[model samples]
Target: MLQMAGIAVAGSCLSPTYASKSRLLVSIPAQLHREFTPPLPAFISLNQRRREVLPSKSLQTALIRCFDTNKAASAESEENAKPNKVYFARDAIVDAAARIAPAVANLYARKGGQEEEGEMGSGTVIHEDGYILTCSHLFFNKMDVTYAADEEIIVCTQDKEIGHVVDAYVDLDIAIIKIDSPSSPLSTAKVGSSSKLRPGDWAVAMGSPLSLQHTVTLGIISCVHRKSYELRREGMAMEFLQTDCAINPGNSGGPLCNVDGELVGVNVETMKAHKASGVSFAVPVDLISAIIKPFQSCQMPVQPYFGWVMRNVRKENLEALKQYYPTFPNALEGVFVQKVIKGSPADRAGIQAGDVVVDFDLQQIRNIKEMMDVMVKRSGTPVDVIVERLMLGKNRLVHLTITFEEKDVAAPRPRL
Candidate 1:
């Protein structure tokens, strides 16, 4: 017997006969049971009355089983929801350099048949038949003078070969040299688009820095469309793609490649002398593509002569111009014409020194570099230009028609 709530309960409730079924039994004193008993509703059945008076073992067991099942399902769900492990390869730069390595070669230029010392630089093979592209300044002296026609340029690849300057564009500082055909087909770099490049993209420069051949340096692009004037390199109308890759003297004319091993630019200049690290410049592949055909055909690329010295409108320059003109537009956004050559296209079109070129050939002109690029494509064609000129202390828009004239650029004699 067991004592519960001042009532004696029979321990036989745990017996096999009662435990085998879903029933429980309890024994209580007669006086207490009658005192605690309450009247049941008429709708309650006999079994319901029994259930209200005694606990049901089947109901308790069912509740415990349901809770255990829910807990186990939740644990399994959490285990399956965990993320999976991933893997990555970190040899992208190494792979990229290896892809374009075969096309890169070391170039040595000798003048007057002197084998003691000569100009040394790097070059990229652009054609499988042995045409190499390099910087024109590589063959020039400190005075910015070209070498004699009889100078010898030796190309060192897997094997030594004689090279000759086929053609050169001095203004852009680009030269193409052709080497004697090798016994096997030469590897050419896969050319990529420079116009698609953006700042912060991976830039890999492969060249010979300080006579170190087949050297590769890695960095990121710093700027695209860097104008020549911004670098204080006047008379060059083209723009450069600036990178933070380490480029040295011998690195000039080497290939600037992307992560996919495609050539995007030709390495040209670096700011190592200024004690700056990772500051370099390259000629954009678009400009290289533009001159490749002409160079191969033994013709010099024609430049359009607009015959005007211009500057991009900037806050500092505009402020300075306002002090003199007093009527210059304060919010002007265009290329400012500083001087117009006499009898030139701009002069004949009524463009004056103080005019701001707002539009050209139906396209808006924002900077001098952009204007130059457009002029190059539309050379030898008639186009309309809109300028903002101050008239009676007020800004007036004037539209004029002008035809671009092709400037005569002499091509170097090709030695086949």
Candidate 2:
């Protein structure tokens, strides 16, 4: 027997002996309609019956089992219901931005007791003792004298504080400023590993864009290994983490964070012509960490110098080169040495112009970027380089070992 919404059902094929027993009182909720009701058994019949019905004990037990199953199913469906993906992503971005907001600071370059509008920039506090990291170019004047003789760097945290330029690496365009926050420890951002990053990962940029403090922008990692030379920034041997996050002039030196609010890169420059195209670049935190580690001991990091101009091997460029040297190698991939500085490491190693670099430090060199990446890591060490050259009207592989000379940007000074 089954009952639902004032309707009673009973099995018609029940034995006469069981039907002669006392009627079973089965009751169901009056509000339950066909939509909420479960399917009835095939042997049951729905008809206008009294409030009580006669049914076998086995049939009564089956009806109770069906109701229990439906109840459990409805509960599971409600439990599985979840919010949209957009809401989850929104919360992630909000939490990430809030985590790093306290460590970001606005920087101002003041000259003649007035703050220069164009000299505004951003920085991230990397130490609890008020050590801020920012771009060195922010303090450069037309004459490029670090900071002008009369200009001062004013760091604005929760309150205004005078900042002193403790160290500056012009080659990498990184600067370290110190502020005296002895009364309280400043908030510092947690650094993350940029080498583990991949394309399409979430990126968050926090800084003061257009002098608006605490600005945050959400974007994805456009690329992980964008070479500096590819962006027309010559002589820089580092690669950047390219992102679509909006980084304006004032956003430079700010922290570029991941979805978990860890600092992965330092916001650097954006394509001026493509400002609306969402093309921006950040210096990978790995390189920044290497450069700043020596600063803690009041020492400057070593800058590796490789005096050679090179480019990737393209068909058009190779054809142009073959016009001059008809015996140039017709290789599909290799770094083409265009010019070697006189008396430099390449020149000293017998590497001449028109040479195609095949391998360096036991690693194949496919482009100038790869060569630069390897050279930066193996600084102040001797490495074997293999190049293909036309010798006596025949292609010959020449092996040479070159040692890189590391130079310091400035002398170490006592900490401020």
Candidate 3:
């Protein structure tokens, strides 16, 4: 044997501690290189051959099974303690706001000399590709001025930084707007049944109050099926949703979302601000479907009544009128009978000039529009009516079964 000599080296240099952990780690190299094989432990003789076979899939499956068993056990352990859902526990209402914010939009209107400022109104996003539902008042051509096609209408939202206008609708008070996200993905509120939205279920309204955009207010659905809006021939009957959501001039056409974030009503006509010490009104989504249906049919529905002309009557005059309306509800039930046009539906229904309409179909008539609504919706449908002879103490609640008489279709009235 050749004499082997070596200088003294530290014990750390050839450490025995790592020998127990030593093993061969193998990989197929891209390029074949010369590699000297390391010797096995003395427990294995040099004559003993090494098994260089691939690991069996049975072994892999066994490892996976063990891991799965541990995981399932852990899952069962966790399941023993029921975790509280953060949304229902605390963020139920907040999540609703987030869901509904995408649908509501603002409206802007400016008359000829109204300082070129815009009026704030709300609208619902009814269609994904851009369709919305709002009140006629928002699009009511009070000034006969057309809003620009790309009017800078602001879309306010909840659970967000602020609101910005996305787009505008010219004919419909409804304005559809896409969210600010470059990504088109957004959570939209599922519209609920206005017919089923009871008077007690949670009622919520979103509006930009007094320049504060996307302000959320809460109230109960105070009433349902309240008489509202004049009816139109060939249009769906208007059944209203009345609420106390503190709606105002700005709240017109806002969405009255339910607790589930479903739109129960469209914030439409509200009580006059001074008259609104507490009450606010919304056009039920059921009725909204009617107003929009004619447009969908590509034809304008004939609204029977014109705009309401408001005027206050003195207490003495109101009392004097009550003498002729003993069957009417005190003195506030009926207003002065204006000129009824010849050959109109009101005229066909025998509602003549100087006829004081005290009540219609058991509903106490407070204004012309409400009475017109009942008469129009019930067109061809009979109703019990109460009217006082013009300037006479005699009054009668007559069940007048009105019929829909076709008038001259030569020239149609303007869209309301």
Best by TM-score: 1
> How far is 118's C-alpha from truth in model 2 (Å)?
5.3
- Cα lDDT of model 2 by residue, 1-416, tens digit: 22532333243124445434644333333334533766444333233342222223224332322222223234454345342333245489999998899889899877677777754889998766677888766753312312232246678777787665554444456666767333466787877889989999999999888899889999999999998888877443678999999888799989999999998998988988543479999988887664444323322232222345455565545565677656567676787665555545566678887788899899998765566567566644677999988888878889998764333323222122
**Per-prediction count of colliding residue pairs?**
0, 0, 2
RMSD to the true structure for each prediction, in A, is 17.9, 13.2, 18.5
Candidate 3 lDDT at 266 equals: 75
Q: Which stretches of candidate 3 lie over 4 Å from their true place?
A: 1-90, 110-118, 141-188, 229-237, 290-416
Q: What lDDT tens digits, residue by residue, belong to model 1 across residues 210-322?
A: 77889999999999989888887744357899999988888998999998888899898897566777779999988756444322332323323344545556554566666
lDDT of 3 by residue, 1-416 (tens): 01111111222236556433543122212111212333333222123244222112213322222222223234454335343332323566777777787766655543432323545676665544233455544533322222222222334333221222222221223333323332232234467778887777778898655655677887888788775333221122345677777776777777898888888777765666664555767766654343333223212234222212111122435654345434333334454433333443455567543455567778877544465456445533345666555334544444443443332344332111
Model 1: which residue pairs collide?
A: none
TM-score of 3: 0.40
Worst lDDT run of 10 residues, candidate 2, spans 141-150
Q: What is the lDDT of residue 207 in candidate 1?
A: 84
Indicate the worst ten consecutive residues by lDDT in candidate 1: 61-70
